[model samples]
Target: MDPFEYLEDLEDDRTKRFIESSNAQVEKRLGQKAKEVFPSLVEKLREERPIQLLVLGNTQAILYYGDETSLEISGRRIKMESRDHVIHSLERVWNSQLVRIGVGIRGSDEGYSLLIDPNGEVVGKIEGLVNQFFYQEGKLCYVKEYRREKSPDGVEPPVERIFCGDEMFPFYPGRGEWLSVTAEEKTTALLKGRGWSEATLYVGEWPELREEDSGKISSVHIVRGRVYYLKGNDVMMDGKRLFSSNHPVEDMKVNEKFVVLNVIKDYRSSLSAFTPSGEPLWEYRGEHVYSFDLMGEDVYALETSFTTSHSLLRIRDGKPYPLRVGRREEMEVKDVYVKGDVLLHGFLLTRGKPKGVIVYGYGGFSVPVLPFSSAIFQELVKRGYSVLVTNLRGGSENGEEWHRQGMLRNKLNVFRDFSTFLSLVKSLGGRTVAMGGSNGGLLVGATMNMYPDLVDCGIIGYPVLDMLKFHKFLAGMYWTFEYGNPEGDDRDFLLSYSPYHNLKEGLPPTFVYTGLNDDRVHPMHALKYTAKSRSLGNDVMLLVNLRSGHNASTPESRAEEMAYVMAFIEECVAHSSSSLHTFTIKK
Candidate 1:
């Protein structure tokens, strides 16, 4: 059968009928059981709390919370930025869930770039994923990916565009490329690169955008009175080699006083700071929670590790001190280590002899999960399921080298690494189930196809399965460099590991999930894959929620999502745990 058979029929009435029937069957089977398990599970989830403070000023900030009080969006709990009087309140904006949207704060927070008032009102709106933003000369410039047209079938795969005030321009942009303004607020440096490999420098004067450059420079960073670019090993400051690093300049951050460059060598990372004239200032090599953010003249860093917890520290006078504090939950994680020849890292959360083993991992997109998000894993442990979280090759856990090792032609290594982890888990006995969402979902789906016995139940969400046609879908072309272009020379490679093309008749009990409003990965992926799986007489269930996009945004939606996951996990454990056994770890 053609793997792309269901592509055109996604919006057909027959497809809708099929999805409705699938939803009905799945609900009939698990609705009662879900009700029995989820209420208490939801209660237990309320115990875990996560709080975030987005700095707007020295004292003023946005306090978003995750707990009972913050049951929806990211829980925008407003705290007054004052030393004496304390006013804690939140604006009950019905659709007020904030996810990846970034808010840029100008001086005194007169009005935000998105026109979000201090009282939490989204007065103005913009279209697209705000990638890089800079505010200067009474104008805000941002680079984002947005579809040109606005229509029902407007899934045109967003192209990168630059929006400055009322004027806008389209520019081809790479992953790490960003928009930056010079310290003197004269020139704007735009870095255009593809997959962070080949960058063309474009330096123009403000909104005029009359960029004149040789186009050979890989990265462009404006600091103080000069513009710096990465050429070989030495840092080029205004056509002059100022300093050299031991390795390639992986990332660059600029401020008025300091130009910080991240050196990533063979999976290790270090941050080095330099003056505009290129005098070495300070170097730092340590594990931290999140990346540093630049606000006006200050570069603030948020420190959160398995040890120090979470706190926002300001880089003032060349030193970092606490600006705002964060709290860590009460749960503890024991027994963590690196594994495999590739140094794949993971931790196990075991409670007695676990009835079911949950293997969770995401090894794609160069993205790495930090210790700050162990709440869900902790909850999974509380439910008597031994949660094994693996950090595989595709992520930046070990820096850019690890990410490269899992991209394009080497993508199979990610699956192999994950499958190896699953093998190790299977040897531990108990009914094993694997969970992953988005690119992680692609990992689990591919693993299940290549090694079905590795997992008894597969929970795949908003995944890319039909690799041949994925690029035609929403924002898929943007990742062709990472996933390999199926329509190009990489076609054979993509087809080799494409999950949808390799599915067998005797698949495992699969619970395929998707959000109807998911404009990112396209819900048709889950729908068509589930349809194909069921046609082959595989035990498959399609679960979908209409209100979510990419993921469940609201607290209620997230709770429903958790309930479905718990229900599926419980069902799998009950049916398969009766036949589990213990075995020694494979060396």
Candidate 2:
């Protein structure tokens, strides 16, 4: 008997019925909301006619363009394409051209200004703009006096300083630059030069350093010519600590006279506003608060109800309008995007028969809904592969409740959820190809074992296959929230779903990929899983990269990985039979 057979046999009839009923309730509620919100979203995108969406990276910019059929990169049209396989990460975008900065594999690289011509045919590349590039009357101007330095190893470093007229300022790595006032004697002197007498010297750790460390900046605002920084729980203005706490500041934005701060502590969080002098203006406690946007004299915040619904709140004249945009009961927006009609939601299972499994839907973390704004997905979709993502309970899409449901002993729901999704897609006359990465990859493996008949083919990347041994590794210990501690009853639950222990004589075709330098999930997960699958006479292919880590380091490498997955899907769909012996695994 297989290890998974225990779970299949132990599933109680009553528990299965309850799970199905709960799933139906959620689907009815969310599916209705999606129907209402998506049509309006599509109309809005159509009216806005947003031709391009630009995303800034560390040293390069990604320009995304969408049409009726697909999403494509516009980098080539702008002449900002890199000859090297890896594109430079974009730091910021000002005027029309994308700005490239920061040190690369080569040391101390100079910042360059990249511009796509109006015709979209010619790209202009200007090097060494650190202190000399300026916007005069909304036009770009170059200062010739700025100097460039090359490291002893002959690598060009990113520009750190920029000269603005007679004054110089430090350029924050990913954020904008700060005014250089160190050469001036006093804060008043610096403010006086800028034609402001009462300007505060807004000081704190630089925004670039904060983004690199925490992955986000809580808040940034310019007041009286000084830039204030609110990072995590600390609020600082010109090196002065205005507020410090143990809480996590999730999001923030500035209005004319005050800076609004949203702080999250544990399960509950709140939103508040303060003056430049650290005086509190207003505060409200809530389960979750986000999407801080400023409009006129009133501050608008996009609020999410505890029930996974959404509404717009307007704060004006010190009063909060509870239903500014729509009634809480009537408004149910699951996922919001800048553009597009599809609103992705996730679910996790907690009380179901197959407890302890995680099912994630489309657009959970980095796994993404294939063919939905993902380059790899589009390529696969073009090849006639139907992709489906299961939002088992434990993903972020449906909020905290859904996530907690799929965690611990409830994790088996993830596998069950995937099985249901695959069955649904196949019923719709579409061949299914399942894919996942990291913890999600663990999900795909577990699903393949329990419902091998459902999944035709799978691509597992850097998966956590052996959940029993996962906590013994480095960052894997932190996953106690999802899988529970190995020493506890959760270990027994995890062992039930551990793909390494559950592999049997026959399984669907599968491909695994991992990086040698992956310090997070470790390469052993992929290696050991592949070895086990091969031992069971299953067709499993593994690809291990020598130099990459958790992320795809270069554009070419990303393209290659996508190509491999696409080819595998083509084979699975074309051949009809899910056989592994026909595929090859390369290192």
Candidate 3:
């Protein structure tokens, strides 16, 4: 029933030609501009090496440092290096001298969780999507998904299981529910039910709770064999409430000594330290804390803002002392009211008066919009463009309720949030380009179709455009909880806003790009959408990278691709009718 359905068979001759022709047209049009900007763009991006810091204890820390091209680990007893793979995650196996590193190639779906000893040798390799590991005694226990055979309808569902040492436990994929493991003396597993409000805690082989304990537990941690969790703005340990906050506890990390709570209100996050028994110590109300860990009596945290790209600080007794800080261009926070009671927030980065504004948003999947990225924004700012990052409804900017308000049947709120922000930007009389990737791609794609007048250009990357059949693609079904079921009642709403189906003539100039190696979001979403849009004589450009995937792309490749995008945005803005520079403030 799908007109461009054949494009899903990527190996077909027609699909091959379609990719080739689309890529060729893009190269011919923007290749020179991309080349001219490649050197400076990559250098600007490379200023801050992608690094992940894991505080070991006391003053020691293990830093996993990498770029698009290479990766290296430091502060360990031995050296670890990788040139052909990207580091996805780094976790220390508790009670052992081993560290588990998740690594995979740039474009491939194949990955492994490698348990490395102090000597840097790979002591153990758990394959097949190994993730969410916990260590009990000296054994590593984790959740894994193994690809199973295709059904009669040619759909392959992964067999999920919880592997503990040598034993395996079957995991039921009930409405995409997931399990988490945490251990101190015993390996404890928490099976989160549908809606994530109810959770069953299993300690070793027995249930560790009564009927009343199955309440809205957001996050769980095992400290000294006691469960520390956040429930309804209250920090609870072993069924006893320790501290309650007016604002929601976004996240919490517990250690043997202290528990650090990250609380958010109005899109701003602050960190507070408390004793294991719920007595408050001190609070650090500053820029958003990216990540943090407790060591000894001090809290080590990474904070970032518009002006600060990265700030490593050590806090003791609520007083913070800077360890390292990286500065970036200026950023300002703006609040716009979509409705009388609904006040949306966002971050804007600019230098002087900009001729164009790039409204970038990713308002889904509980992810918050943080103005930490410097490279692309640097290049765009240098080109006289301002960047606006929106913390829309579907994100964790406000809280969990914000996420729930923007997902499932309430998904229209996310689009309305974006459209309202753009309406504000466009009213300022400057060319506005809407950009987002992954779920953000879906955001922009749907918004562009519904409110094309609000956007002068649209950049949708690795998008899910065909909402009706998106569940049929790889990893698409997993998101059914976030984006409602297409075969059910949600289908009517999905079809109403699905970008692939909603594409019409006179759409703003759009740049749709994806990769052949993107096994997560199928490339067909981009190919088919571009094919149909172009067939309708819409100004839609497509670029399918041969060597990249949805993630783990090298710096050089990303810089080159972003250059092409910038070129497209530049061209689109140049041709748009908006002229008045500088955002007009509504006084």
lDDT values for all models: 0.61, 0.46, 0.73
- 542-583 per-residue lDDT for model 3 (tens digits): 999887787665667677788899889878888865564555
Report, for all candidates in order, the number of backbone clashes.
Answer: 0, 46, 1
Give TM per candidate.
Answer: 0.76, 0.46, 0.90
Model 1 bad stretches (over 4 Å): 1-10, 36-113, 116-124, 127-141, 148-157, 170-184, 196-198, 207-221, 228-288, 294-341, 578-587
Candidate 1 colliding pairs: none
Q: Which regions in candidate 2 have their CA more than 4 angstroms from the true location? A: 1-252, 255-372, 577-587
- The residue-by-residue lDDT of candidate 1 on 138-181, one tens digit each, is 66555555533422223343555566676665454442233332
Q: Candidates 1 and 2: which is better by lDDT?
A: 1
Better model by TM-score, 1 or 3? 3
Q: Could you give candidate 2's per-residue lDDT for residues 305-360 as a string of tens digits? A: 32333444666755678643321221111221111112223321112121011123
- Output the lDDT of residue 220, model 1: 61
